[model samples]
Target chain A: MNSASEAQYREQPAKRLRNAAIRRTGSSAFMTLLGKECLELLRSFKLVWVPIVFVVLGIMQPLLSYFMPVLIEKAGNMPEGTVIEMPPPVGSQVLADTLSQFGLMGLLILALAFMGIVSGERNSGASALVLVKPVSHTSYLLSKWVSMMILTWGSLLLGYAAAWYYTWLLIDFVDVGPFMLSYVLFGLWFTFVLTATLLFSTFLRSAAGAAFSSLGVAVLLSMLAGLMPKYMGWSPGALSGLAYQAVTSEVLLPLNSVSWWSIATAVIGIAVLLMGSVVLLKRAPAHD
Target chain B: MTELLQVKGLTKSFGSVHAVKSIDFSIQEGRCVALLGPNGAGKTTTIRMLTGLLAPTSGEVRFHSLARGEDHRSLIGYLPQTPAFHNGMSGMEYVVYSGRLCGLSASDARKRAMELLERVGLASAAKRRVGGYSGGMKQRLGLAQALVHHPKLLVMDEPVSALDPLGRREVLRLLQELKSETTVLFSTHVLHDAEELCDDVVIIRDGEVALQGSLAAIRNEHRRPVIELKLEDAPHAINWAQSFLQKSRTDELRYSWLSEAELQGNRLYMTASHMDVARQGLMEELTEHKVPFSRLEVGYSSLEDLFMKVVSG
Candidate 1:
């Protein structure tokens, strides 16, 4: 018993030294891992295809909105003299419509793409190989998170810029300030969904399961917020709705108490989810 | 030599299923050790725990050179049974990436990766995607990645078990060369592979250590005289062989030298304590009983025989 206690006492300093070493090299390892993740994304053509898909989704909204009356007139079987009356679409409203398209199809694509970010490596046992090195679990998880954020933000920026360009060419001009503000809101909502997906991926073994469960939770939250605006006004789910309102109002500063509440909630939710994922990753850095 | 590492009562349990029971062993520096076990005997589980891939339910693996509780992984180079890599990355990229993860600078990682790839005979295929690598190439690439940091202890799980004979020979030869340079702890079910490369052997059965010692010591301790008689294919010879076992069981003084005897078909096999006395007694009995025997041979028991007995019993 005395020897056992002495052994434990001797271990404390070594444990501290080991942790110091991990901390010292942790950032470099994270950068290397982040580079690898980005490289993988590029090699797999996900970086190109995902942004392209977002761009197509973004462009389709303004194109379809601009030509909706004509499409209706052409598709509807009416008399030769039949004329459809439709209001000229507002530029901000069309941008909001683009955000809605992103809210649906764009979020789905991001969720699916990010679903396998961690689970795929864990499943393929590739993560096991890396984790066995002197790499820290926090570094591994954070690297994935950072690279994912880069992809999500980059794709969203590019796709929204395309939408803004097309909206200006075909429709009325939108205020850049309000348009960018709404873009942040939309990005936050997408961030929430992606964060949830990442958390699920780190904990769950199946990539498909991670994707579906996260999507399911996002859908549920959005529906709940939509159903009860007064009660669920501060929920992260309200970010999408706030984004639409911010764009449609054409207000340069759309910072209401409710909007601030929702943004804070979303930001907090993202932090908590990221922290949870890091914890999960540390506990089971590799699952065979 | 000094001790390199020690495994103290390491155990693992997955809910109700115990994968590895309490196991204890130590490895000395610069020695090659084999964790010999059959399939499902927890060899992989033990290796995982030792390499810090899997958490042990109880007990610990301690590296002697460092104080306890240090991250010994920096000193350990691990290769899984069926190593999986990012199939999209080239062999060179993967090794360099591994080196970087182990805290090497980009330039150093590249240089080391180049050196190791050439050493593993993978320099020619370095630019090829790992997905295109054959089994032997992948195994060699696995070795390169594991060695990127020039680890003090190299751990491998069933390193050559999944390979064809040609691939197996290639890896075995590599391991033979590597064992001289670093402390190696590898698991294998093949006794011949263990005997060929390892200085120490730890045989496990059902997640428990059956026996463990230096190979020379185990060989010397378990060696015993064995005799075999190929009898004529006749009713009289077969009957005599059958009664021999029963007689040895009952008659103590005359057959005391015979520790065990068994007859299969017309052949008789026996293990004896004293080879000369047992041979003399058998020859006299055969002549007196007029037992028609074709041949008689004497030899010593091998590690294979001991392994079979320990695993089966």
Candidate 2:
């Protein structure tokens, strides 16, 4: 037993020494930025909490809609001879409600999540530390953007899954096929919107400025889609509303384009935002 | 030794104000140069430009690495005046993360982090969050992060300003330990700090170098032996002594009144070049004038005195 314990101790020291050496040699500029970003997220777990709460709210939306008729019956609000026609809460209706609420709210939360990425670092004097490292501005901004995207997508997935299971449990029917496709489309749209918001965050040097600028950009895109005929081919606002329309099969006015156009626009918008973020990060003063 | 860092006519401007104006200085291998300046004298700006955090408006900084041959970023480690770290990470984790950022692999980063934490006297608190560490502990951790990569040049901006006396001593001692392996360029407004730990000193004033030399050489060049005399009642005795010294064929003596007061007795102090000149001059004048005095002493000028003279002048 003594010999076995001695052997274990000897093996432990060598393994520990090897791990230590590996830790020291493994650090690269990109890895450091990524680690720093992850640490920042962990510090502000509330950033994670806000989206979780919203996702929980998304999960509850379908259940609330399905039980509304029962609730009204319990409340005895029905008048005599009144015909209260209620749509079935199963199939696409459940999917539509969950998609609309989760997608819109998720996009807003995702935008706000990144609003502090660059500006907060600058304000806290962390930018000086980061810039002094071997990392470039592009890698710093890209790491933050990627982290936000991952968190946002992860939260969205959780909300989608929760809502799907809950709705099935409530209505005794589940359509997994359309639900999965809808989730993918919604995730793509979210990625596009988040990338655009991050671009604004990187461009503006203050948290409030980034948040307001992103909101303004979103509003302006919506307005252009409403007012301009030639802008319909590439308006990003259509992508935000498309998740709901796809789930519900709701048809709006003719725009003379297929669904692929919206997808392409989202892809182009994401590329532009990412490129613009990189440029803004490169040009931004290091110390300020 | 080859030049590790060379700055040629380096200049930086913020709007209309020139923070660093055509300052030229260089650090050879294994030399510690202390940059001394008053507040707002552009010491921080100069360090920032040297570290490549800020681009110079006009001029160049060429850093030659012994190991990697001429890549500035690979060879320099910079500790900013107020170092900040991510709040969630422990001290060890933060240092390791910084190591990784400097191109270390994960295991190597951790190993270096542990070794450096122990060297900085922060081994016990390695697992504690950096945000929980005291100001001095954080500064030491910052130093550890900067040194973990083993860069050839370490640039620190006022690293000891926030530390307590003990902390200051610890950090200064750690810097002394690192002197043989790394070229350290630290900026400070504290002259004694520079005097204690620096091999060479650069005094910057009005965005330019006022003086730069080895500490001993600067002290030797500026050193002047003098005697200070405090009188009991003779305000006019000082003036009388100055004139008497001038006529006695002694070295030309200059006198300035440090203070005039009547606390506990009439106290007046004057400075002169030599002890004998001061003593004889005072005796002759006081004996002739029948004046009485209490105190007289002699001392050499300190680095603080020299610093004040250069900065104020």
What are the DockQ scores of the candidates, in order? 0.71, 0.40
Please report the candidate that would top lDDT against the real structure: 1
Q: Alpha carbon lDDT of residue A96, candidate 2?
A: 74
For candidate 2, the per-residue lDDT at A237 reads: 63
Give per-residue CA lDDT, model 1, range A120-233, as digits (tens): 988888888999999877778888888888889889999999999999999978888888888888888888889999999998998889999999998998999999999998
> Candidate 2 — which residues are off by over 4 angstroms?
A1-28, A39-51, A77-83, A164-185, A203-205, A226-233, A250-265, A283-288, B66-71, B227-299
Tell me, per candidate, how large a share of the native contacts it keeps: 0.74, 0.67
- Per-residue lDDT tens digits for candidate 2, residues B121-156, read 999999999889999998998899889789888999
Model 2 DockQ reads 0.40
Off by over 4 Å in 1: A1-21, A253-258, B250-254
Q: Docking category for candidate 2?
A: acceptable
Task: Summing lDDT over every window of 10 consecutive residues in candidate 1 chain B, give the lowest-scoring window.
Answer: B64-73
Candidate 1, true inter-chain contacts retained: 0.74
